[model samples]
Target: MLRILFCLLLAAPALAAPPAEGPSPLWGMLQVIFGLLLVLAAIVGIAWLFRRFSMGSMLGRFQPARVVSGVMVGPHERVVIVELAEEWLVLGVTSRNVNLLKTMPKPAGHDAGQPAANPPFAQWLAAAMDKARKRQGDGDK
Candidate 1:
C-alpha cells in the first residue's frame, strides 16, 4: 500500500505537468487577431447586405429628395432650394434647424434634358484665356 501511494503521487505530478507548455504567445495572439478579423468580416458583410438590398435610402445612392441648389447665407447657415415630388422648396438651413422659407411650382423648361445655361468655371476660364490670346495675336499682327 505504501509503494502504491508513492507511485500514485508520482503519476499525479506527471499528469499535471503544465499541459506540454500550453499554447505559445504567438498562438494566443493569432487567435485574438483571427477573432477580431471575424468580427470585422461580420460587420462588413452586414453593411454589404444592407447596401445590396437598398434597405436605407439615406445611405443608398438613390434619393427621392435632392438639393437643387444651395448658397451660404451666414457662416453656419445656408439658403437651399430642394426639389421633391414635383415641387420646389426654398429652405433656410442652419446648424440647428431647417425652416421652409417658400414653396413654388417646378419651373418651366427646367427639364433634365436641357443643358445647363452656364458652363463650368474651368471652361469659362479657358475660353477667356483663349480670347485674350487671340486679342494679343491680333494686336501683334
Candidate 2:
C-alpha cells in the first residue's frame, strides 16, 4: 500500500501535464467558439427557413379560423371572438380551459362578396381632425 501511494504521488505530476500531441489551448478554445457559433447559426437558419416557408400558417394569410377580437379579463384569462365558416363565436379562455360563451350571427353589411369597409384608426382620426379644423376655421372667419 505504501509503495502504491508513492508511485501514485510520482505519476500525478506527469498526468497533470498536458499531452504534447494534443491541440494547443488557443486552438481548442477557437474550435469550441466556432462550434458554438455554428450551432447558433444553424438555429437561426432553421428559424429563417420556417419563416420563409410560412410554416404552421404563422403568417395569418390563409387561416380558415381567425380571431376577430379579444379582450383580457385577467392576467391569464380572455374573452375572444373568433370567426369560423362565416360565423362568429364568443369564447371564454382561461389558463385551465376554454368555454364557449355564445354564437353570434355575422354582422349586417358584412357581405360575403365584399371585404370589410372599416378604415384604419389613424386614417379615420386624420379625416375627423381635418373636418374639425375646417369647422373651426370657418367659425373664426
Candidate 3:
C-alpha cells in the first residue's frame, strides 16, 4: 500500500503540462471570444425559434377567458395566469398573486416614450426575494 501511494504521488507530477506548453494570453482570449460567439449564436437560434412559434408575441396578449386570479395559500403554491387560445400558456408568478399591493406612479422626468430603468422598489423586492431564499434554506437545514 505504501509503494502504491508513493508511485501514484510521483506519477501525478508528470500529469501536468510543462511551462513551455502553456497557452498564451491571446489564445485564452480567443477561446473566450469563440465561446461567447457560440453562446450568442445559440441565443439567436432560440429567439428565432421563439419568434417562429409566435409564443412570445402571443403571450404579450392577455385573454379574458383565462384571466382568472386567486390566492396561492401554501408553501410552493403559486398564482397561475393562463391565456387560452391556439397556443395556451400558464405563467406562475408570485407577484401576480399579490397585485393588490399599492403601486406608485412612475417617477417624473422619465420620458414615457423611452423605456424606463428599474425602480428602486424593484431592488427592495430583489432583496426581499433573497431573504425568502435564505429563510427557505434555513428551514430545509
Candidate 4:
C-alpha cells in the first residue's frame, strides 16, 4: 500500500503538462473566463434582439380582435365587450359557458380620426394599480 501511494504521488507531476507546453496557466484561465463571458454576452444580445424585434411586425400588422372592456357580474362570471373588425360583440362569460349577448357596429368614436372609448393597456394598468393602492390605503385606515 505504501509503495502504491508513493508511486501515485511521484506520478502526479508527470500527469500535468510541462511548463513550456502551452500558454501560462494564468493566461489560460483568463482566456477561459473571457470566453465564458463572451458567450454569455452573445446570448444576452441575441435575447434582446429577439425581444425587441420579434413581435413588432406580427402584432402591428395583424390584430384580429381586441377586448374593449369587461366587468365582473358574479364571483365566477363576467360580461365582456370585444371588438372584431368593425363590430362589437357583447359576451356573457361564466365558468362553463360563453354566451353572446349582443352585437353592434363599432362605436362612433372609433372613426379613425377619434380614439376609441377603451383606454390603452398602459393607462388601464396604471388605473388598476391606482385603485389597488387606494384600496390598500383604505384598509390600513
Return the top candidate by lDDT. Answer: 4
Per-residue lDDT of model 3, residues 1-141, tens digit only: 999999999998798676576798999999999999999999999999988789767877855544333334356554333333422233444633533332233345644335333444345555866999999999999
> Candidate 2 residues 93-134, lDDT tens each?
999999997887878766554544334423544586699899
RMSD of 3: 20.8
Cα shift from native, residue 62, model 4 (Å): 3.6
TM-score of each: 0.47, 0.45, 0.28, 0.47
Report every candidate's CA lDDT.
0.77, 0.77, 0.58, 0.80
For 19-106, candidate 1 gives per-residue lDDT tens digits of 5577989999999999999999999999999887775665646567777766665799876778888788878899999999788887
Q: How accurate is candidate 2 locally (lDDT)?
A: 0.77
Shift in Å, residue 50, candidate 1: 5.6
Backbone clash pairs for candidate 1 read: none
Between candidates 1 and 2, the one scoring higher on lDDT is 2
Ranking by lDDT: 4, 2, 1, 3
| TM-score-better candidate, 1 vs 3 | 1
Model 4, 30-100: lDDT tens digits are 99999999999999999999988987757678677888777665799877778888898878899999999
